[model samples]
Target: MVCSEFAGCNEAMQGVIRYNPFSNVGFIEAMDQAMSLTPEDKERRMMLTYEHITKSSMTQWIDGFLTDLKHSFNPGQTSYYLGINFSKKAKHKKVNRLMQVRQGFKKLNIENCSTSLLRSNKCAIIIEIESLPNVKFSRHSVPTADVIETIHGLLIDKRNTIIIVGKQTRETLLNWFGRTHSFNGNELWFAAESGYLYKAGIKENWQKLTELENVSWIPQARKIMEAYVNNIDGAFIEERQSCISFNYKNADQEHGTMFIHDLYNLLDKSLKGTNTEIIYGNGFLEAKASTVRKEKLIELLLSKLTTSSKLDYLFYLGNDSSDEPVYELLKSERAKNMFFESHSNKFICSLEKKPSEADFYLEDVDSVRSILEKFYNNTKKKKKIRSFADLTKITNSIAIESQRLKKGTVNASSIANLNQ
Candidate 1:
């Protein structure tokens, strides 16, 4: 369960089809069609109605009201595509700018102009005019694949664009590219090369999106684009695994800290602390958590084991400092173990089990739930037990390559060399 869509469902159950956020029609459509049917949908409507007024003369009305709703950053012409997410007060400044934009929209409308609601939030709205326009956007319409191919071809003989993304997505893409590159050795193209011989598709030429998400006509646009570009890889995770995890107590600040903190608490509580732990001290805010006693982490791991028999089928779950010590302990001769980035790619620690399975592996915090779910369904009550081999997509050429696995925890140096 790499995503939340199938969180509570049994492992034997097939995963559900989850909707994409940008399913195309528009956020306005989401407000009107998709969301209206849900309970929370009606709540947003009740709370954000503008002065009991029905919209008509876009500008004379509240053109900017909906557009400026929480609007600090303007991204794609589609206002829905942009705007920083509000998790905590981390975006108070954006909120402030959004209010200012909304006020400006109101003033413009009072002067007798016409516009229509394009997008909206509580603090801001994006208004479009029926007869005039303010912003000029370069227009191109095609499938995402076409754009990827076009750009990949364009950059083929030239330079590669550097992109940044949220850490998870970055890891996911990096893993994919590294694994693929390692197999092919050099010649790789999204359009020219199939993903793999077994199940082939366009190469995920994600490298092309870097420029669009980085270059902007305005400096603020550049900053916003940079933010998205900088965080583009943040969304990747274990695709076929039993868990979803993230640990951001160290890297995020303001709202990001709050966001990770919320997720940590949620995972620890919902999954039950028997298989999980949340690492934070009151000193984190006071900036003293840096000095906390880390020696206790080993004891914490020991406490989780009921038999004290040295973690026979363990999965070391971690993402930050609290995780490092655990990883070290798992790698020691005191235990019998093999590690995996996920459950599939075993970085065979001791050459013990022919790289076919993970006696135990290390996945970042995002994967704990999956590890536990697979563990529970496999060991606790086993009816239809599935081996790790059953989950592989084997290619005739890559089959031998699959048998070869990375040893020990997948570190930055090994990850960097994954494509070789």
Candidate 2:
């Protein structure tokens, strides 16, 4: 029997066939599945509508035009970029309250709701929260301590650096080191979902947190500080995610795409011996009942964790594929509160939609980039024209195009008009 999720009545998505794969009910179904949103899915249909237009060839041309425009990278403070979707999701007065933490900004790997920004004197770290479940998952087979330490060292060069974790990993971090975490409303609905905030592990009283669900759950600063304490003590606090879920599937016209750059960088580090603490491997089916001994490998990895004195949001992103038995194991362990040996902190972020909770749904990989563009446009700030290099120093097509213009290679169009 076909089951409905969130709000079971999808009249707009009523079964209908079409000729072009993109125009068929299957395509719509795929979009609906991929979004993985909830009863309010219809309210946020624009997420996909906007995506369809963005996936259009014209959108790519625009993206290319902008990207061709240079780049630089300086390790900066981290911030967890999440999404609340719309302004009305919750009452406005609660925005600050919802962003509250029991303690001030500290570390990540120990929170109820993942923090968007964490600050501390020990080291300033940033984190960006993302969720891309479609990509193939692997155990980050390239686990190495020397590499991990070296990367950590580079971030600490300035004392305060940023790190990022996706929803899937957020829950994992919460489990590894008991703590509470959360992001703001706008932060919840960001498109690129790229930002990093350093999070420290810490302990908390779950019973107390539940009581303050409406009031200030905790102050942001205190949360980060608590996170730091947890990082140092290795005693994480516990909490669970709200009830509800969303789901979106891929259509034949398009295959899902994740930030190749993100995965590639991680893989590069692993292969280059820069990040040896993490490892990746063969498919999950390889283990029918037995895949690579995940527990033992994790055991070896956990041993490495002990040597790193302070807590940091060390995260791993995974998706469905035989290569990701570890991802499944992590998911399973999180539910059982068996993240790492001696790990008692427990929390849930609902990386996978449980039903009735997701509000912003989407399909089409282009939609991700597209939705982000709109969000960016909607909140257009009149800051000085930032060079592509200036926009996070990460390579962007817009920056490339801007460079071409600088060298008289392209037409003179305002950066403001790139989206138009």
Candidate 3:
């Protein structure tokens, strides 16, 4: 790693000789010195260079850079950047102090969900599939292979994993999971179309939870959304089994909002008396049956699980308006009866501080993935002494071996006999 002493070359020149590239004389002298190095010195320099490069890979650098960029958003302010404040009050001083204190404690014990919590408990993890880390909400986008494998591993480890998705159809979900044949029908579950449809496993058929046999308003809503998409340049429509979404992620923000407002009013008025509702968020508007409630799906899931064993922990993650019902349900007093008195529950949103019912927030998709991966890794089973008798026997053998060593009577034959 022969480089000049420049601004960004310091890290690269750490384990090797440096040369002044600007001066011919110095560069030639440095090359000659490098050529005269001993074999041992060359090996030492190679080892150091390898270690440094391995420790500072490009992936790690990019991760650190993105993390720094996210932190620069200024969490204390409601705005994305540091600018003027139109709000009546800024972040409270006491709140900032408490946040700092909490961060310090977090650093001391980074793993909030520990192994003991998972090992001795029956846990349920309900997550909105689109909120997964790095997963785009676009119709063409799908969960990465890594994400699929990680989720499969989590399911195989015996954690009750349930996925809630709004825009994706049952066929899309099946195809996505089909890419990885490792998915088992009994291990994973799906609550598709904002909990209007439920499927217990890959092999099971989707069951409609709502009383309405058919939603006649879907075609009318789709027609209205399609007209809007045709008029808007970058807007599009995604039709699911029980939901229809008007996506404007690629459209002009100001114009998209106006278009969505008009569409929402039209759909709201047209769908009235039909038990249909409309919801709009960041860049999309969706219409679905009002009877399709996530709270009811959760209740059904708990009812089934409680018949076998009480849940000891419940973790729910979401980042959309549709997920608020589940959050509100979990916070209610009636939901507490589904778990033990010492049970733990966490409601997390995959966004920064915002108007959400979630009790905790993660910065972005990457942060969400990192936390789930940690939970998966920590909950793995570990080997331990199964019984007190086995522990006592091992301790007695160690004591006898130490005595033999101290009495100068230890030998290969004695060791073999002890082993026997």
| Candidate with maximal TM-score | 3
Model 3 segments more than 4 A misplaced = 1-110, 114-120, 134-138, 178-186, 250-255, 348-350, 381-420
Models sorted by TM-score, best on top: 3, 2, 1
Residues 35-68 of candidate 1: C-alpha lDDT, one tens digit per residue = 3355674455444332223332446436444655
Per-residue C-alpha lDDT of model 2 across residues 250-359, encoded as one tens digit per residue: 11112111211222222333334221112211111010111123333333333333344433322332222221343344446452343233322212122222111111
Off by over 4 Å in 2: 1-117, 120-291, 308-316, 321-351, 354-420
TM-score of 1: 0.19
Colliding residue pairs in candidate 3: none
Please report how far candidate 1 places residue 222 from its true position, in Å. Answer: 33
Which candidate has the top score in lDDT?
Answer: 3
Computed on alpha carbons, the lDDT of every model, listed in order, comes to 0.25, 0.28, 0.63
In Å, residue 179's CA in model 3 sits off its true spot by: 7.3
How does residue 91 of candidate 3 score in lDDT?
A: 24
User: How well is each residue in 1-420 modelled by candidate 3, as lDDT tens digits?
Assistant: 566543243334346787544356768988888899999988888897686666666886677556655665444543222222111132221111011111111111225544544554466777777667544544444677777667666665454455545456777777776433433333667776777777766666788887665677889998777767866778888877677888887788887875565577568768888877687554778898777777788788777666777767666776666666776777777877664345454443435445555666666667667766766665544212223545688778867886887798776566565566
Provide the lowest-lDDT 10-residue window in model 3: 93-102
